[model samples]
Target: MATGADRTAFGPMVIVAADQHEARPLIDDPWARRLLPASGRLAAALTKYRPIRRALIAPTEKKIPGLWASMLCRKRYVDDALRAALDEGGIEAVVILGAGFDTRACRLPALAKIPVYEVDLPANIDRKRTALTKALGRVPANLTQVPVDFNTENLADALARHGYLPGRTFFVWEAVTQYLTEDGVRRTFDFLATAAAGSRLVFTFVRKDFLDGTRLYGAEAAYTEFVRKRPLWRFGLAPDRVEAFLAEYGWHEREQAGPEEFTARYLRPAGRDLPVSEIERSVLAEFTG
Candidate 1:
């Protein structure tokens, strides 16, 4: 059973799951829809467990499917590219930052072959455990869950305690940075920088201008307004400046693509029919230490 804090921490799962559900059929991968029912269950649980925040999340859920579809179309390519880089480098360990109901550890065969360490708030982990147990009847053998409040825990210390090898790891920070403060994001990267020189990072960012625009869908605007009330959460990156930002922290940009480029590379021809204008508004980046 989750407490109020736990429920609150697991709130984002609803949004992500909702987004995946909407976008799954549009994806070329046959297994995409497999993630939907589980995501829906988790979303419902959070709603029942924490009504107010769930209500706040509802509006976002509406916009999520399309945005998520657009994002995942690109992310699938990025994730595959990152996996290829890891394979080429002989890196086997992976740490997923803010792993919210994400099924990569279970769904991606190549990723599942490696040991995956999923880091998130304690409540979210618990919620994920429950959801996975119910959906799959068992969690993946290679998936390990690490529970920590990023504000209170040192990522390095937590990784050390969890037996993460400093020299052989890949960190995937997906749609998580926007919820964190700039300093928090920097600290996370700094900690990763201390890992082995070859360790890599794959992440996505919403350009600040996307948030500044008012033409987003109704649900998008509602969620944005809600997030505005939370001081810790806001999209805070300009696509042009991300490479410079990473350079300052000892990471080298290995590859980067705007959403449109990503779609062109990974998505099927039909998936490409979706409007690309909004997709180009954000960027995905890969970095190597």
Candidate 2:
């Protein structure tokens, strides 16, 4: 989240997303794979010399897996599934907020014909653009990068500047809300609330209990250690209160799934068991008014 020292954690998150750790990856992002640092590419490439990915990365990843990377895999599973369903159900545009190194616009074939707007801070956009151009020569035509600092610019204003339509849409706000202030979170929800009817929003949040000292998931110590020097999680809504929270913004909650739910609904069905069970949770909401 900072400019330099510890930096945006997107790089490591992308490394795990691009890794073929699972037999069938929840998300496939070549841009992530291609943009990796030399050492990361070497390690990631070494894993998949076709089949060695599972064997080599397994042992080392167990020692220190990427924080929230597995959770992202689960979140992406539900989010992408919801996206595909909504795409067929008639959403016209896809907007990805805080989309750092996310490759859904390029990777999901269903989105081939849909316009994708990716919003992020200018510096992060520069890094993403540089790596993308270096790896693939040019960014994709269907994808538009909108650079804005969330603290200063409104999400609605940024998208409107780039010709975003207030029509049927699917908004993906992955792993971003926890980084914002409570007021910022409300501002975003307010925007989503007014999106054309039938538009849906998919976003992730940390459990409020995690912040208030009720860690049920057994991974707390390691998670605590991980965030010691990093940007701390800023805001959260209790899982049980998400419905009431959404109601305040004129949206109706459709589904809220945690790692356990994701495991049962996605990973188990795929017969894929991640090294560490993820802890983050996601809520899917639909505009009601």
Question: For candidate 2, lDDT tens digit of each residue in 183-222?
Answer: 8788888788878888888888866666555663555553
lDDT of each: 0.61, 0.69
User: Residue-wise lDDT of candidate 1 within 1-289, one digit each (tens)?
Assistant: 2212333333333343433433333333332233334555555445434454346444544655345345555456546756676669767688888786666787677876788999988877876787677667877888888887665578888877887776566778776776666777778877866766676777777556555554443446434553554433455577678779888776777666654564576444545344333523333344455
Off by over 4 Å in 1: 1-66, 210-224, 230-232, 276-289
lDDT of 1 at 143: 87
Candidate 2 is scored at a TM of: 0.84
